[model samples]
Target: MTHFKSQVFLILNELPSGECIGYGELAKQAGFPGYARQVGHLMKNLPKDSKLPWHRVVNSQRKISFAENTDAYWQQRHKLESEGWIIVGNKLTLNEFDQKEER
Candidate 1:
């Protein structure tokens, strides 16, 4: 894997179950502060059977990035909610689950 991808994976691996970070924050933690899109790309390409908690990453708005009603969208929401996250409509209140990014 490339260094950048490796960094992204490392960050994903470190996220505690039920916790989440934004795409931009993941990029920043991966040493690419302005590369949020790259982080999203890396996430999209993760292997289908991969154990990484890709669902734990959201948009900067603290919302699921996937389109509602799609399988991916529901899957992410289900995984997160199963882990104690509160989803109101398409947005998750990050603070309720202690998953909000520290400022």
Candidate 2:
């Protein structure tokens, strides 16, 4: 895998549960600003059975990118909700579900 993609996966794999992020935020965290589309592309191409937390990612607008009512859309929604996320008016803010770590 390319270095950038590898970095993205590493960051993604370590994402804390109950935390959501945006595509742009994911790209920026991976040290590639303005590469939100690339992050989205990676998400789309992930293996069907991949264990990556792709459901934790949303759009820059704090909204799910999937078409409303589509299977993909519902699937993403279900996953997020199952993780204790409450989609308010179809919007989910990054870090909305974050909890303070017990350092």
Candidate 3:
């Protein structure tokens, strides 16, 4: 993998189960502070069967980045809720489960 991708993957791997961070935060932790869009792209391109916890990453608004009614959107919500996260609509309850950039 490329250096940036490797770094992003490392950040993703380090997220504790049931905790979630924003895409921009993930990019910052991966050493690309302004590359939130790139982080989204990387998550989008991850292998469907990959074991990475991609669902733990959300948008800056603490909402699911995916559009509503889509399969991916529901899937992410399901994965997160299954892990004890309380997501109402697309917005995650950040105050309760916010695991911000704590590097």
Q: In terms of lDDT, which candidate is strongest? A: 1
After superposition, the stretches of candidate 3 with alpha carbons farther than 4 Å from their true spots are 94-103
**Reference-based TM-score, model 1:** 0.90
Runs with alpha carbons beyond 4 Å of true place in candidate 1 = 95-103
Q: What is the lDDT of residue 80 in candidate 2?
A: 86
Measured on C-alpha atoms, candidate 1 has an lDDT of: 0.89
How does each model score on lDDT?
0.89, 0.85, 0.88
lDDT of 1 by residue, 1-103 (tens): 8899999999899899878899999999989899999999888888899999999999988899899979999999999998888999878875453654453
**In model 2, how large is the Cα lDDT of residue 20?**
77
Query: What is the RMSD of candidate 1?
Result: 3.3
Task: State, as a TM-score between 0 and 1, how close model 3 is to the true structure.
Answer: 0.88
Q: CA shift at 102, candidate 2, in angstroms? A: 17
- Over 20-101, each residue of candidate 2 has an lDDT whose tens digit, in order, gives 7889888999999999999999999999999999988888677889888789888998898888777876787433334333
Candidate 2: deviation at residue 32, Å?
Answer: 0.8
Ranking by lDDT: 1, 3, 2
Which 10 successive residues of model 3 have the least lDDT summed?
Answer: 94-103
